[model samples]
Target chain A: MSTAKDTAGEDMPWDEVTPEAARKLLVAAVEAFAEQGYHATTTRDIAGRAGMSPAALYIHYKTKEELLHRISRIGHEKALEVLSGAAGIEGTPSERLAEAVSSFVRWHAGRHNTARVVQYELDALSDEHRTEIVELRRRSDAVVREILREGVESGEFDVPDVPGTTLAVLSLCIDVARWFNTQGRRTPDEVGALYADLVLRMVTAQK
Target chain B: MSTAKDTAGEDMPWDEVTPEAARKLLVAAVEAFAEQGYHATTTRDIAGRAGMSPAALYIHYKTKEELLHRISRIGHEKALEVLSGAAGIEGTPSERLAEAVSSFVRWHAGRHNTARVVQYELDALSDEHRTEIVELRRRSDAVVREILREGVESGEFDVPDVPGTTLAVLSLCIDVARWFNTQGRRTPDEVGALYADLVLRMVTAQK
Candidate 1:
């Protein structure tokens, strides 16, 4: 309900904002939202965390929900960036799928707060924003599903239920945020590699 | 800080506090916590949902945190109940693991609200209660890790990292609550079976 336009500065670009300011604000927003529930977090908290005035934040975004929308959108786009980069690689189904899974796990482990806010806090978004985020999430899921389907059709995997299998794979990656931390015995790379192996085996054709 | 006093008609044993009543209150607590969050849900909200007066609710439990504690404890205990029952039964590693995974997924699906509240709302608990719940969660994680470790030791599986692999397996099960619904494409049973198979394949030893 807190609109951002109530607080924009004269320095804001007409058509787009600067990447550095947006990134700084997004990082601060992610931390605040992760620490406080989306509904409980105020635009002031994000602005304070970013060391900027509320007016400066408003200058960059029109609404608090708009900031959340941007955060969710960026998270989804980053995931797509990882998956899209892996899509064209030349490899067997298992290899390509493992790479995709590895990328996802690493991305999640490194940017856990962002991932958590995006995945768990979307329910707090406006209906339109929620729909947009959900669609982005669907596309992300589809990337994994398409890989699994390709593996099945190519005789590299033998999953009986394509959609469920897709869910299983993504769930394994998305849940890293719930438990992964620097204090854990395994590094992000270690966990990512192990998950990649686990997922590959899950879908690969049984010997 | 709502507390429930044991006042089961003077002569009843503590353990005899009727599962129906306890379950009713537990379900109500789960719903209230899920909808309004742990910090926001009051004993009265749960009591209202369970069609009971606050005094009657207090007769069964001590503290709102205790209610959360009980819900989490019971949920983990239920998981251990299934695991302990299935333990030592004669089967291949994949078969046994599949049964375990199925039980976990099915339990979470059936207790989705409890699962969500326990997993997502721990931040609202006091430190002592939170520590207690964390221990319970760790014990549950230990059960799955033991299974994976035994599989690896017996050459039934070949995981390089036991802890991460165990976390990955549990992650797959835990994330089900976030997405599973009665209106979902697959019934809980179907999802359970698919996930069980997928998990089994993930950890089964290569031929």
Candidate 2:
């Protein structure tokens, strides 16, 4: 197996560095964290999973905590990125809401392991780190809430409690990771489309 | 500093044990498992929290896995028990469903720690143990699905997808343990009532 030191010779410059290396590292970290949880996962495990030595792993990230923090941040950021893009598309409130839900389900399905780490491992971080990740989570939640709030305000949805509805929608999407797996019957796209329909029905006003 | 032997000297029979003792042990196990995860928690840790030693702990349960299994089995049984009881009451499908949701929320709120362990720790079990627990979970889920299916058949609920709606409802309720702490602003009763209302609205046909 190539050691982390072996990869050091091929390290690209900052601007030229592809996310391929970091992405592979993050993917391995997510599987380790999800399987063994945050506190149990060692840097060596992540390094081994990524097919690199511990020293080579350190070339990409400083500590096990740092690796967790980076994966969580990236997962949150990617989710926000997708939601923000969804929010920009022009459509009726119901239509836009459906699109946003679809985006969330798709993102979650594609990155279920990373999503699990982001959702469950926040407590393993230090106070400052936990706060930072919580804020990121809040922002992602707020994006979904904003879309639902807009739907409710526009009379397209009739939620009795805005906060509860927001939580319901987000929870439905988030919990998909707990059960969704390749071993299951439905493909990610199928689940995503079905979820989008269900969510839309959940929030939309009865005709 | 008392051992489990000292603790079980009291005349609390297994069948007639006080809810207080069971609750105490369950709470201690929850905190230990939550902090250390299931694999890392020793019987001593749970006994330590319950102010007893391992021998006393074993009086109520044969093994650590048995304790964990009972905690989960009891939680699921209580929820199913509530649902079964609620189903016998005379009401519209919507009303009964709301009552079922209320019962679920109350059960989870009252036993949040046990709920957390039951929801999150199955993966740590041996394959045979995990399968048994999974079956229990599926049976519990089926009770909810039966209620929803009855509603659909009676034309009292307007959910688009029966299985998907069942999942959404269960997901919303189960995720409460992830964030519902006693320190939060809302009381458990208040949260339960609010969630019950949300579920009713989500599934009920408009007047």
Off by over 4 Å in 1: A1-25, A51-59, B1-26, B40-64, B88-92
**In candidate 1, residue B106 scores what lDDT?**
81
For candidate 2, lDDT tens digit of each residue in A1-207?
222211212111122224667656766787788777777678888889989888888888888888777777767777788887887699987787777778887777666776777887887777878788889878877887888889888889877777777776777778777766656666667777877777776677877
lDDT of 2 at A19: 63
**Candidate 2, residue B40: CA error in Å?**
3.5
Q: Which candidate should be chosen as best, given lDDT against the real structure?
A: 1
Task: Looking at model 1 chain B, report the run of 10 residues with the lowest lDDT sum.
Answer: B5-14
* DockQ of all candidate complexes: 0.52, 0.37
- Give a tens-digit lDDT track for model 1, residues A174-201: 8887777766677778888898888878
Chain A (alone) TM-scores for all candidate structures: 0.87, 0.85
Question: Cα deviation in Å at residue A148, candidate 1?
Answer: 2.1
The whole-model lDDT of each prediction reads 0.74, 0.72
Pairing residues by index, what is the TM-score of model 1? 0.82
lDDT (10s digit) by residue, model 1, range B1-207: 123322211111224236667756876787777665676577888999989999988888878888888776666666677665554467766667888788788867766766777788777778887787788778777877877888888898887777777777788888887777766677777888888878778777788
